[model samples]
Target: MLNGHEEQEGVNKFEEKDGNSKNYDESDATVDRHRKILHTDNLKLQDEYQRLQQQNNKLQLLLAEYFQRKKCESRFSDECTDEEKERCYHNTLAKLKELQEECVDQKAHFEDQLKKLQEERQKTEDMVETELEIFVVYKREILLQTMKRHGGKRVSLEDLDRLQQVEERREKELARVQLENIKLNMRFSKYQEKFKAHSIGVDGQHLIDYEELKMENHTYNEKIEEQKEALQKVKKKISSTTHTLTQVKEKLEFIKAENLVKRGSLMKLEAHVNEKKEALKNLKQSRDSLWLDVKCLRCKSGLLRNVDLLQDFEDHCDSNDALKEKLDYLKMRYVQLTQNCREFRRKVQYAKQT
Candidate 1:
């Protein structure tokens, strides 16, 4: 009986030890599974940290490149003359300050946008967590009811596998969001580069237009100066013409006064010539009367001499000779005066022709 009891005790102890060993093995497996999950979490964190560090390194390289380019451009600035350099420096400083202000504004706007995006993300996460919690609670109640109906039967393994697939799908959606964020950042960078290039092109075009406008303005100013000179010359010529006209008018007045004086002299000479012509006519009439008287007296004396009238006849003859001489002299003087009047008239007419 003791041996049987002792053997039975040994069997029980072995079975118990076997049970303990199985429990220990299961515990070890559970611990190993937990350790694997922890290692996965640690690896994920390490990868994220490495990615962040790489991003930082890329940003630093970009900044260094920008600074180097700026440094290289500084040498060209030294080539400008002092006056131009001073003006350019002031303008550049003003422009740089304006660009800095714009950048600051853009940064503030982007930060605000980021804050809004984060808030939206947080809301989405909360909603997802709430939905998950509700689903878990509902599933637990369904499981309990199913167990009650099936005398504690478990859910199907296929259903559990489907749930795991849904979880993976959610993880894929999160990864898609991350990829979209990366694409957006790249697009933003490309846009910035294009904008900078466009601004440079616009600035160059503006400078060219300004230079053309300046040249046009200078040309117009030259034309105005030429026109002003031409106007001044025209004014001088006009003044000279006006002065000449005044002189001509004065000369015309003098010519008119001289003509009046000459006209008065011509009238006096005409009056003298008319008086001499009248005296000549009177002398010729008197001569004709004397000839008639002498002829009549001779006839009478011839008759008387036959009857003793000889003395009277002699006296008459003497008187007739004296009268003849005086008549001749008067006729000569009249002819000379007539010739003088004709010569004077001829000279007056000639003077008018010249």
Candidate 2:
């Protein structure tokens, strides 16, 4: 009887121990389920964050590229040569064409990515909703069981506050993400507007205008060259004329000096001729006196007949006539000299006037 009682007591103890172990196993399983669900939610949030980060990076890169291109254009526009500008323009045009093609490709790629992201977001949202529903159901069951065990006691106020805080944090994060998405969309719209503007015929029109301007520039350059050549010829002619004028001025000075010397000599000759005329007048007066003396002697011939004295008187008269003829010849020579001098002076004056 003692042995049977011992055996029964051991069996009851084993059954109690098994029941305790089963309860512990059940609690561990519930904890593991909650942990797994939280881990999956965290992973989904991380993936979404990563995707947004990648998109932001892409947008930033594109913006940087655009700003760099604008800076290059502004720098080249400031002070480069026409050839450099033309080269830059062609390069810019080629780059723009490439960028346009890239933009088209990127637009298509972005559209596809956006569609994919939207679908993924919808799927994630559905999954989160289902998970939330399951969690709610599990929480309700736990709460009911706790209430039954604790005779209707509510959860702690601190726990409720903590949950509210978590919910607020989640809402804030969602709002931040939505704002970022809006900013990205705005940037994309701006890029599209830029692309559209570039797609117009502005480049073609500019090319046509550039060609016309080049033609005009060539023509203008040719005209400038011709003008320069004509100016050179005019300058040569002016230099030659100036040299001739200087030579003529030198010749005129030499001729003027010669004329002055000749004028001085002519004046001296005129004075000498006037002196000769005065001398001739004195000689003529002397001859007249001698003739009167001769006449007086002839009247006294009957009172005193002296042949020698008459003959001497006749010789004196003949010598006086010869002296008078010589005076006449000198007077004619003086007149001729005066006439020649006057003629020479008149010719010199005429030459000076001319």
- What TM-score would each prediction reach against the true structure? 0.28, 0.27
* lDDT (Cα, tens digit) per residue for candidate 2, span 1-354: 224345345345434543454554565466556545644654455455445445555654565667677787877677767888689679967976886687678667866766766666666566655655555454433333323322433543344344445555554554454444444444444444444334343578656655665565566556556655655655565566457435644644454454456556656777898899999999999999999998898687643577777788889999999999999999999999999999999999999999
- Candidate 2 achieves a global lDDT of 0.59
lDDT, model 2, position 261: 64
Residues 1-354, candidate 1: write the lDDT tens digits: 124345345345434543454554455455455545544544454444444444444544455556566568777667768898679669867876885676577667756765665565565556545555554454443333223322333443444345545555544554454444444444444433433433443567756655665565566556556655655655565566457445644643454454346446555666776788898888889888898998888787676645444566667888888889999998998999999999999999999999
Model 1 deviation from native, Cα RMSD in Å: 60.8
lDDT score at residue 303, model 1, on the 0-100 scale: 61
Error of 2 at 54 (Å): 9.9
Identify the candidate with maximal TM-score.
1
Report how far residue 295 has shifted in candidate 2, in Å: 99
In order, the Cα lDDT scores of the candidates are 0.55, 0.59
RMSD value for candidate 2: 59.3
